[model samples]
Target: MSAEEVHNRISMLRAERGVSRKDLAAALGVHYQTIGYLERGEYSPSLFLALRIAEYFGVPVEVVFSLRPFPRLGSEVVK
Candidate 1:
């Protein structure tokens, strides 16, 4: 099947969790470069991989990836 453009919050979530790509990749049982590829949108992860990542980050899969661009945090807030 054709892969969809799955935008994700991988970088942001990893940063917030103080996780390096290598650490996350090791936890996900993938090569460290796979994390880079995912972060750069150069590769789309399989559903199982995506779910595993979501579990690692303590968030739902939808919170980690979306088919459409997600709105920026606080973008809905007024000054």
Candidate 2:
């Protein structure tokens, strides 16, 4: 069996938005370390938290999390 993995773009999104980990953590009602863990792929957010994060960032939930690694933004997809 493959090891469980949850891929997210929290760090990239946060960087693009210029949002601090502490600030997002406070807004999400979680410890700042939780944000770090999520960013580092050491933890995955709950459904509620995932929705909250998407809403907070003003993006679709699909923009934040995915079952597969996403192509780089603005990069063309290979055929």
Candidate 3:
């Protein structure tokens, strides 16, 4: 899969926990934009950052991120 197919587990976990992006950002000591970027696939976080996010969400890292097979260019994958 192309790197863009790397999904951020943060969004899903946040939804599950009812945690807002702002709250996560505060916990991570980052700007809210950083969270938004990660959630939108516009940014790929470092391993350390990924671990931090997963820790904050009280989940294993793999639960949040996955190397999904790359979809066809004009198609999409539903969650």
Query: Against the hidden reference, what TM-scores do the models get?
Result: 0.91, 0.86, 0.78
The lDDT per prediction is 0.94, 0.89, 0.80
Q: Who wins the TM-score comparison?
A: 1
Tell me how far the alpha carbon of residue 52 in candidate 2 is from the true structure, in angstroms, after superposition: 0.4
Q: Give the candidate order by descending lDDT.
A: 1, 2, 3
Clash pairs for candidate 3? 9-64
Candidate 1 stretches greater than 4 Å from native = 1-3
- The superposed Cα distance between candidate 3 and the true structure at residue 78, in angstroms, equals 13
Q: Which ten residues in a row have the lowest lDDT in candidate 3?
A: 70-79
Per lDDT, the best of the predicted structures is 1
Q: Is candidate 2 or candidate 3 better by TM-score?
A: 2
lDDT of 3 by residue, 1-79 (tens): 6745677667767888899989999999999999999988888888899889888878888877777733433575443
Give candidate 2 misplaced runs (Cα > 4 Å). 1-3, 77-79
Q: Compared to the true structure, candidate 1 yields what TM-score? A: 0.91
Q: Which ten residues in a row have the lowest lDDT in candidate 2?
A: 1-10
As for candidate 1, its clashing pairs are: none
